[model samples]
Target: MVKAAFKVRHITQRYLRPPGALKEKDFIGRCIRCNQCAEICPNNCIKFFGSENGADSMGTPYITPREKACILCMKCGDVCPTGAIKPIKRELEPIVQYVEMGKARVDEQLCLSYQGKSCGVCYRACPLADTAIKVGYMEQPTVLDACVGCGLCERSCIQIPQAIKVIPNHLLASQLKATHLKERRSGDNDVQIIKFK
Candidate 1:
């Protein structure tokens, strides 16, 4: 059972939630599966997981940036009857601070800019622009702390395998915890423990 659970976690594709969504555990409990977030999304980026995704995820709103990246309009949160998705203002500061959909990671080897092709599409597509996705040396995208993981960069990426991807916070937290435990058990000195709570 433990091995099966670990295998599922390892294989599951991390999905970005709507802006202002609570942590996975809390969101699952609070969400009423009303589909309000999906209906209110102006960009129509929010979609519910089907039965094949499993009972826990079925009917929960998730965004696949490859299909449609969030524009960060905050309308989904505004229409949420429950606080599963917290209501946030449509301002820059609040959105940056409160909206943590995921974090974007870049694969330097596959990036066009890193290949000397000078691609800046990801930087240009980012709504936060200079703050979230900045163009660094050789026009390479530098994801900054201001990134709210709206996945505009991933959506705009022209790379075949996608040079950039957003790692959902829930999955990231669990992975980090697992790594920390593994490192602790091995007594690895280089391990940087990060507590999720």
Candidate 2:
């Protein structure tokens, strides 16, 4: 049971939806797997899962940021037949406001800048620059809330194992939902539970 649970978790974390993706359940249901999203992607970062990611995920478009991060052209969303990937504008504000693929996290131990070497590659790669990521002394990168999780920073990182990574929004959403459920079960009568999904 433990091994099966771990495998499920591992499979869940293996991929991320395109920008402006709907919630996981809704996306899986709404997406027709028409391959339109992958077809319109200029960066060629989008790929489909086979039986490896399970039946629900089969043919669903996903992005592997380490291989190629999204350029935020917003083309994939524009081409999607269903609302699974909502059409977001190519402008900075709309993209920032609507797109939520994942959030980038920096591992200080593996980061060169954090280890006393000056490296600002991630910061340079960020489309939002100072708004999404900031660099301090020795070019140590700091991720900010405005980050749309475009994954450019992670892709640009110089570390062998990648000092920075994007935690997919689907995973974060699931965690948030779990926490909400746990809180509701705690028997707090006045605590208003907000629906995330």
Candidate 3:
């Protein structure tokens, strides 16, 4: 049972939460596990973590973009009783500013466009195409700062191992913490050594 549980945890790591979700820690605390977000999602992309995920995260809604990417309908947040998913106005500016579920990254080596194959499906699939992703030289896709991590690119990629993927914000948050620690340690090591002359 423990081994099976571990496998589920490993698999769920790549899942993305709905847009406007709070930081992982805060979201877990505030979420009521009511499944309201999942129920209200027009695209039916939201799903609950099951027993295999264990009690820590069981029942909390998450999305597996490989299965069904979010359509950015902005409905899930509006129906959430708890503020785990903060509601944002259904407008491009608000969605761009507040709905950061993750950031899309492209693996150039695996992208057809990078190999001169002329594939730009991922770029075309993006809801925020011009803003979030742009076709660069040779048609290679370039992720932009405006990306809301909707996973549309991932869903549309034709590569065997998806060339573009959404790196969830929870994972990004951990990476930020690790980077901060490294910076702090280096700063402490550089503390000026004053020797009384």
Compare the candidates by lDDT and give the number of the best one: 1
Worst 10 residues of 2 by lDDT: 2-11
Candidate-wise lDDT, in order: 0.83, 0.82, 0.81
What would the C-alpha RMSD of candidate 3 be, to one decimal place?
7.7
C-alpha lDDT of candidate 3 relative to the true structure: 0.81
Of the pair 1 and 3, which is ahead by TM-score? 1
Off by over 4 Å in 1: 1-11, 189-197
lDDT of 2 by residue, 11-67 (tens): 256467899998777888899989988888888999987856656667888888999
Ranked by lDDT, the better of candidates 2 and 3 is 2
Residue range 84-181, candidate 3, lDDT tens digits: 99999888899999998888888877989999889999888999988888897678888888889889889888887898888888776665666677
Q: Candidate 3 regions off by >4 Å? A: 1-12, 179-197
Clashes of each: 0, 0, 0
| Candidate with best TM-score | 1
Model 2 Cα displacement at 137 (Å)?
A: 2.4
Can you write out model 1's per-residue Cα lDDT over 1-197, one digit (the tens) per residue?
54443233312677888989998878878999999998888899988877545566668899999889999999988899999999999999999999998888888889999889999999889999987877877898878888898988899899978998887888777777788788889989677543221
Report the C-alpha displacement of residue 168, candidate 2, in angstroms.
0.3
Instruction: List where candidate 2 sits over 4 angstroms from the true fold.
Output: 1-11, 175-197
RMSD of 2: 5.8
Question: Alpha carbon lDDT of residue 24, candidate 3?
Answer: 75
TM-score of each: 0.88, 0.83, 0.83
